[model samples]
Target: MSATTTYNGNDTFHGWAASAKGAPLVLQEMTLKQWTEDDVEIKISHCGMCGSDDHYLCESWGPSTYPCVVGHEIVGTVTRVGKNVKYVKVGDRAGVGAQSGACQRCENCLTGNPNTCSDLKGFILTYGSRWPCGTPSYGGYADKWRGDQHFVFKVPDNMTNEIAATFFCAGITTYAPLKRTDVKAHSVVGVMGIGGLGHYGVLWAKAMGAKVIGMSHSDKKRDVALELGCDDYIVTSDKEDRKRYFKKMTHILCTGTSPDFQWEPYFDLLKVNGHFINVSLPKWDFPPFHTYDILKNQVFIHGSAIGSPNEIREMLKFAAEKNVRPWIQKYSMKDVNKAMENFRAGKPRFRFVLEN
Candidate 1:
C-alpha cells in the first residue's frame, strides 16, 4: 500500500463547523488531509477568533461550502509529523496560522515568499479551502488539526498559548508591514480602530519604541487605548485637532473597517513618503481618493494580508522578548457559540481565544 493508505486509520478529528450559510456553527467530525510525507498533525490548544470567521460563515467574502470550518490563529502542541518534517517534533509547542501549504517551486516561494505562492491550486489555506491531495481543509476550532508541516511554526519557550494565538495572524499581519516600512523609535505611528488587529498594532508599535498614537471616531476608547500603551490619542471628530496634525505622522496603520469611515482626512496625516497600511477587511469599497494629495505627500496606501512565515518567527521572538501581550478573553471550545455571539457584537476587550 502507498504511504497515504498507511496513515488512513488516524485520519479524522472533530471541530465546530458551519452547517449552513449565516447559521450557528455546530460540532462535526472532520476528516484529515491526505497524510503526505510533509504533513504535521497538531492537538490544538488555543485558537483566536477573527472577524474573518463571521465573514466566511455569512458568505460575506464569497460562496463557501456548507459545514466549512473557519479559524486561522492557531497555537497547539505537535501530536505527530511526517518523516520529512524537520522543524517540529512530537510534543513540541507549535502553531498554524491563516495559511497552511504553498507550492515551494513557485517564484515567490523560491524567493522565500511562499505566502505569495503563484500556484493557486497548490496553496492550501487552513480553512474554506482544500489540501493538495484533494481532501477538505478544516481549521482550529476543534480538538485537533492537520496540514502540511511548512505552515506550522514553533511557539516561543516563554509564550503562553493565548498570547501565541494572536501572533499567528494579527501580530504577524501588523509586524510585517511595520518592519518592512522601517518603523522605529523616531517614527510617529498612528493606529486606527482599536479592534483585534488594531490592538496588536498599538502594542507592537509601542514595543518597537515608536511614538504610538491612537485614532478613533471619538474618546470612548481613549482611556483603554492609553492603558494599552498608546502615547497619544486623536479624536477624529475634532476637525481642528485633526488639521493641526496634518502631515505629522510617519506611519498610520488602519485596522478599523466600516463603510462610513472617512478616508479623505487620513491622507493628510502622513508625512512625505509615509505609509498607511490597511489590515482590516471592511465590506464596503472606499470612496475615491484624491490623486493630487497622494502625489504631493508621496504616501503609500495599500491593504495587507496575513503575514509570512519568516515574519511570523520574527514577531513571535520580538513579542516574547519584549513581554508584549495583547488583552484577550478566553472561552472554552464547547462555549464557542456564545463566544461567537459576543465576537459578533464586538464585545471583546481586545480579542478572543478558544481553548481546547
Candidate 2:
C-alpha cells in the first residue's frame, strides 16, 4: 500500500506558534492554502524543531514576522501533486528542508548551488518568510503544507517519518561540510559539539569510515558520543587533556555555538595541512591568531551551510546504506511550543521531532 493513501484530514488540526514578539506560542487553527501546478500538498506527519527556528521565533537573530510558523525539518506524505511534479507523486512519502523555493534559472540554481544563488530574489524559506505570491509560508507546525515540488524529497522506504524529518535540515547541514572536506576512510575527524549537529557529525563521519573523535567541554556526553560511533571523546575543558590530543586531528568540524571558545587550543589540535570548518553561526569577532598557527601547520578555516539537492540525495542514500539513524525525541505537532521550549533548554536527548 502506498504511504499517502493513509492520510485523512478529517479532524481539525492545531498548530502552535509565537503570535508576536516576546510572546509565548499560541495554538491556532490553520487552513492549507490553494495549491499551484508546481505544488505538492503534504499532510505533515512530523516536524523537527531546529535551532534556526528558535533563533527566528525568539527574534534572537532578527525580528520574526508575527504569526510565524517556525519549523523546517518536515516529513509527510503527498496528499496531492500538481501535474508538473514528476519527482514526487501523490501518495509518496516526502519531506521539505530549510529552503522551500529558489529561482530555478539563476546561475547558482543552474549550477546546483541554489542555496548560494545571488540573484535568486524570491527564495521562499520554509517559514517566517513570504512566498512570491505574498502569502506567508507556514511550516510543518501545521497539519498540511503546499510547497513547490522541486524542494520536496521522497523519503526512503527504510526510514521512519520521525527520523526522515530531522534529516531534512540538521543531517544535511553537517553532511554538506563533511562531503565538501572529502572526509573518508582513515581520516582523523574531530567534531566540536555534542548537540544536534555534532551528534550527526559523529554518526556520519564514522559511517564514512573516519576515525572519529567527539570533542566537547565536559565528559557528560562521553558515553553517548562513543555509542554514536566516535572512536574517542575529547573533553576540551581540561587544558592538559586538550593539549595531549593536540596535533592529532586531520580535520576539526566545530559545531559549537559558544562564542567564548579558545581558538588556539583547537588550532593546536590540527595536523599539518588540516582544515577547521565551522557550521555554527555564533556572534563573535574572529580572534587574533599568530601567523605561525597557520604557517606552521598549513591549516585552513571555513564555513558551510546546508547542502544542495544532489548533496542531500547523496547523504540520504549514504545514511540509508549505513543505517545512520539519528537519536530523536518525538512530540505531537500540537506541542510545538513545548518542544521549542525543551529545545531552548537543551532538554532533548539529542534532536526533537514533532509528529502531526
Q: For candidate 1, write residues 324-353 as lDDT tens digits.
A: 887999999889999999998878879999
Candidate maximizing lDDT:
1
**TM-score per model over all chains:** 0.96, 0.92
After superposition, the stretches of candidate 1 with alpha carbons farther than 4 Å from their true spots are 3-9
| Candidate number of the best TM-score | 1
Off by over 4 Å in 2: 1-14, 31-34, 283-292
Model 2 TM-score, all chains together:
0.92
Worst 10 residues of 1 by lDDT: 1-10
Deviation from native of the Cα of residue 103 in model 1, angstroms = 1.4
> Which pairs clash in model 1?
none
Summarize candidate 2's per-residue lDDT along 278-339 as a digit string, tens digits: 88865455578888778888898888877788888888899999989999988876667777
Alpha-carbon lDDT, every model: 0.85, 0.81
Instruction: Report the number of backbone clashes for model 1.
Output: 0
